[model samples]
Target chain A: MIIPYLELAISFLRVSLSAYGGGIAAISLIRHEVVVIRGWLSVEEFIRVVTLAEMTPGPLIVNTATFIGFRLAGVPGSLVATTAVLSPALLLLTALMLAARRLESRGQFRVRIQDAVKPAVLALMLMAIISFGRNAVTNLSTALIAALALAVLLVSRRKVHPVLVVIAGGIAGLFLL
Target chain B: MFVVFFRTGLLTFGGGYSILPVLHYELVDSRRWLSEQNYTDIVSKATAIPGAVSVNTAFLCGRVLRGKKGSATAVLGMAIPSVTTMILIAAYLFEYVHHPGVQRFMKGAAAAVAAQITYGVWLYARSAVRSVWVVLATAPLFAGAFFLGLHPLLLVATALVVGGPFVYRKAKLKAATSSPESEYSELME
Candidate 1:
């Protein structure tokens, strides 16, 4: 029991420390850790894990961590894994906040860097959309469902919450497509 | 403050920067806890860092708004929903999730997720510094990421280096911008 827990801690600590460019980008790194290194999950199982992560709330990386941890042990395993994944990040964040504070008098220096990199971040999001679209919208029927869902989201002035749209999409798929 | 982050975490279905619109709505538009500019600044920086972008945003925004305690509250609030929900799913739904009907339902959910993600990115792009140069950079980035398979990190580093002139020009114009923060001050502070 302790051995599994220890493995969980070490594996996810390594993941959090090394998985740069979070979310979908971390998927490959996570796959390497769980699938290749530990042989905890097969390739097919790993794909399911990622899909499950995508469907849930919160950070993709964290969701994946929780699921894998629970599978490894139980509820306690999940907590340990989540904490391990977050530990390194929290420390780094503290250091970063302090540095940002020291640069306070620099006058929009931080802001300018943000502006400079904003487009690249936008580009990354664009890639996420593209990659997600390819995986999710496979057939013409699924494509139509996605388009209608998008239409509802856009037409409602975004008054309709995305979760509702997703639920509707699921129901629509059950009967219609 | 905790409530704000809690709701954002609860609603961010696809995570990553999907929380962008939720945060904007909660912090910037509805409450005004953050200015429009400040939100984008936090978001952009969050994306570039090593940690989870949403968690990083929660921490930075919390630090800016209140203090360390605020950051603690915000990060905890941000984490709770995902941890509990995933745990529940793992214990119960993990077994049944592979069923055909459930899989179909999840598949449909994925389609809507793609659409919602499109909306999220659009919101951020609009609020970000919109300029011809940004527009110019976006197209090639898409091509490079798709065709050349460039890493997102590499792309961001390239953007920062290429956009180095902007930072340099501002420093030159200001006539004595702070020479990057010292390692000592960053640590000792």
Candidate 2:
């Protein structure tokens, strides 16, 4: 039990440390680890996991860590993984805040980095879309469902919460699609 | 303050960019924890970082409010509610999620997720591609990631290293001529 718990700690630690761009972009890294490498979840299970993460409210990555950890070693494992995943960011951000205090004059430096990295982050998100789309859009029906969801989200401009959009898609799948 | 972040965590429906409106409403509008500009600063910086955007925002906000202790408190407040709920949800999901109807519904949910991500692509692209050069340069990047199937980390690094200077030059040039005030605004807050 302890062994699996520790393993969950380490695995999620690595994932949280490595994942960038957050949200769906981080899902790719989690998929590569949990689904592809460890075989902890199969492809279909992975899709379900992503869907579950989307449907529920919280940080997607943290929710994923908790879910995977629970699957590995129950409640304790979930706690361990959550802590492990969060610790790095806590430590890094604290240290960065400390360091950044002294280098207060370097204001423009950070802006340049932000300007530089924005497009790359955008590209990463694009990759996530393509990869997930390939897996989810298996048939014309699924494709139409995807298209409808996209149109709603785009047209709404976030006026509609995504959870509703997801539920609508599920209903469409059940009845119309 | 802790309550504010806790509420933000609990209220954020879809995470990532979803947290923005809640933050805008609570911290910016209601409590006035920070000005709109300061809030945007925290958000953009949080987005640029490698971790969860909501967590990052909480950390930065906490830091600005008090210090390390505040940061820790805010992070815990933001994470705990969602973590507790997720454990229950995960346990429930593991049980009957194997049902055929449930599976089909989830499949549809997955397709919606793909659509949701595609929408995110449009939103991010609209914000990030500010100029013709950016559009030109990032097109190949889109191709490389979508077609050639390069690792995301590799692409991110290559873009940062290769595309950084191009955009920076453009931004600097525009800042010098057009809007000198806004150029350094990102870091000042």
Candidate 3:
């Protein structure tokens, strides 16, 4: 069990490098790792955690990793998972911080690199919405819940917090779902 | 500085790229701790880093505010809430989340979240779908992902190989024509 856990941690670390392209795009990669390959989480649980990450007050990837970690191996699991995702990133960031002052022409490269990633990010987002949408919108009740939530979000102009909207969806589920 | 990022972390629901406005308000508008250019530079560079974009942003902001310790402090402040919240959920709600009543809750929550994700993707599209070719290009990518279940890295690699040269050439053009001042100005708005 421990060995498998370590392997899982290593996999998480590997995934950290590919965590670029702004995060929503990374969701497809994460979903693939969690649900498709590892089978650590079912689609429903993964979706729940993604929403829960939104309700929590941190980065989505960090929250999702921590939550999934906790669900898998308890506190230690969460720690390992979070550390796996964060440590590589933090190290790389620290090195860049030290080096950035000397490096000229970073801004142009940054723009081009981001631009190069854009189409892929767009495609990944498409994959995430279609695949996750299929799993999430399993029935009419769920469909209505989604439509209502989208409407509420649209109507509110995003002034209403997403947490409130999600919690409200839970309440709506009590009767409707 | 730690207190600032701590507060930002607590306020950062839906974190990824969402923390930018909050950070901007705190650092540039409210406290004036950093200038507008400082904020823009931090954000653009941060997203390019390998970590969670928010964490990278927070860490760099902290580093800018103080030094190495500041970066560590900022990241710690940002992460504490997430770690604690997840632990509590694991210890308590893990079981109940799957209960019949809560399963219904989960269903609804999932739907709402999925809808929210759809809205987010649209926003990303507005920025990313620069040309009609991008739209045409996605069909094969979609089929690969949906039907063949190819890994995201493969698709991403494909996108890089296919789309990179055009954008890179455009960047060269901009570098030739425009001042560095104008490049970041687009982001300021």
Candidate 4:
């Protein structure tokens, strides 16, 4: 039991380190690793974990890690996995924050960092959209709803929130699906 | 303060994009600690770093508002609620989640989540894709990941290799043309 818990902690650490651009981007990688690579859980189980992570609070990565860990090795495993997934990011964040403060005093350094990061962030977001879209929009109803949601998001001036958009989609899904 | 932000983090659903309007309202419109421009700028920075945007936002906001202590409080607050909730749900999901109504609700929620994610991608693109180069780079980069099934890290690394030099050169040229004197002074300072 202890060995499995340790293994779960190490696996989650790897997943967290490799996952970029946060929860949504990490979802696929976690799914691949836990379900496909490690066989700790099946794909359906992975999806269920994702659903739970989304529905619950906190960041999705940590929530997912905890869920997977608990399933594999109970409560203690959950604690270990969650800590392992989070510690590296937190440490790196502290370092980066310190560096950013130092660099902010220098205009050229700040500008250079901004210039390099902007388009790269954009590219990463685009990748997230495509990857997630392929998986989520498997039918005509979902596709149409997604398109309408995009249009509403881009063009609407009512300041209609994304949550409301999601709610609307949910309503549409209930009626249509 | 930690409890406040932590509750906010846990309640937020759909993902980063979904949380933005809320964060805007809470921090800028309501709390007034963060300005609109500042919030947007921080969002960009959070996107660049590899983690959940909400957590990153919490950390930055906490640090800016109240320093290291504030940062710790905010991070813990934001993380705890969700962690607790997921654990509780995981414990009982197998027995309780199989109801037909619940399943139906989940299906609807999943579709909505997809839409929310798409909306976020579009919004980010609006800010990030100001130039022709960004427009040109986005599609193929996405294709390389989605169609080719290349890992996202590799795509990021490739984009850095291929696009980094050009962007750096452009920024340098802009600085050179705009105000070389000020740039040099600032660098020296």
Candidate 1 C-alpha lDDT tens digits along A81-145: 88888778778768766775677556433325676677678778788888778888999878988
Top TM-score model:
1
Model 4 per-residue lDDT tens digits across residues A86-152: 7766677789777866855664533444445565566666666665667668788878777787777
Better candidate by TM-score, 2 or 3:
2
Error of 3 at A86 (Å): 2.5
lDDT of model 4 at position A112: 47
Candidate 1 on B1-189: residue-level lDDT in tens?
Answer: 998888778777777766666676678766788887778778887776665878888988998888889888988899899999999998788777678787788788778777877776777777774678788877777678889988777777887888767755764555444444543333333
* Pairs of residues at least 3 apart in sequence or in different chains that clash in candidate 3: none
For model 4, residues B1-189, the per-residue Cα lDDT tens digits are 776686567666645544555565567755688765466556666666666666776777787678899878877887787767777887875566666666555566566666666655554455556688766776776667657876656765676678778766776676667676877765553
Candidate 2 lDDT, tens digit per residue, A43-145? 8888877767765667788788878888788888888888887778767766755675655455334334445656556666666566567877899889999
lDDT of each: 0.78, 0.70, 0.71, 0.69
Q: Among these predicted structures, which one has the highest lDDT?
A: 1
Measured with DockQ on alpha carbons, how good is candidate 2? 0.48
Could you give me the TM-score of model 1 versus the true structure?
Answer: 0.86
Q: Per-candidate DockQ versus the true complex?
A: 0.54, 0.48, 0.45, 0.48
Chain A of candidate 4 compared with the true chain A, TM-score = 0.79
lDDT of 1 at A172: 78
Q: Is the docking of candidate 2 incorrect, acceptable, medium or high quality?
A: acceptable
Give interface RMSD, every candidate, in order. Answer: 2.7, 3.9, 4.6, 3.0
Minimum summed lDDT over a 10-residue window in model 2 chain B is located at: B12-21
DockQ of 1: 0.54
Error of 3 at B14 (Å): 8.9
User: A98, model 3: CA deviation in Å?
Assistant: 7.9
My TM-score estimates for the predictions, one after another, are 0.86, 0.73, 0.67, 0.80
Looking at model 4, give its docking quality level.
acceptable
